[model samples]
Target: MDSGDVDFAHTDEAARKRRDKAVGLARYVWDRGIGGPELLALPDDRLRKLARAAGANPPSTRETWSVVAEMLDEKSRWAAVHPDDPRAVPAHADEKIMWVKPPLPPWPSR
Candidate 1:
């Protein structure tokens, strides 16, 4: 195959990977009870931070994700519109949540 064709294949693979990651981040946030309205209100930077916080497992350096992924997620278009009163609500709700994790095996775990 020509060099151009090889480059296209690699580009396509990278695009697919990015798309999958964006979808995963969205689902993770939604499962955390953060939906469309709240999502739309957040700036891309804050949203990416939120996504990383909500990640099942996230990488360290690439915390903010890519512009391409943000665009695909429709977050790039969401400009950070500061609320008239930023302090209107508590950052965290008062409710308590119980999270469950699998029990550690008798054998050493990763």
Candidate 2:
């Protein structure tokens, strides 16, 4: 991905920091034998406690779930980009597409 493609000026530092923290929390859970499925299976109260235990401020049930969902989304994007890696599991191929050049500037009309 080209850095130039992004509008860094408009980027939200706060949101990025939050997401980064969430990713770290999600990773911590996974490393501790609690991946997405296990996390989702835990009761709501337990999930809130889990978030607090991870040092994340008292997040609501919805916020805790969002962390899992966001982490899963990031994971899927990673798998899509690294299909050949042994650790990458295949997600639904329907929504995943490998890179393709933009259709614009239509390959020099010959």
Evaluated with TM-score, which candidate comes out highest? 2
Q: List the residue pairs that clash in candidate 2.
A: none
By summed lDDT, the worst window of 10 consecutive residues in model 2 runs over 93-102
* Candidate 2: C-alpha RMSD after superposition: 16.6
Over the stretch 1-110, how does candidate 2's per-residue lDDT look in tens digits?
58669764336874575576677666555434344555566667766666676687644435546766568657757767997985465332231222111236758768
Clash totals, every prediction: 0, 0
Judging by lDDT against the true structure, name the best candidate. Answer: 2
Clashing pairs in 1: none
lDDT of 1 at 51: 55
Candidate 2, residue 24: CA error in Å? 2.3
lDDT of 1 at 26: 56
Query: What are the per-residue Cα lDDT tens digits for candidate 1 across 54-108?
Result: 6634423242244324542453233233234433222332211212122467987
lDDT of each: 0.46, 0.57
**Prediction 1 TM-score vs. true:** 0.38
Off by over 4 Å in 2: 1-14, 70-110
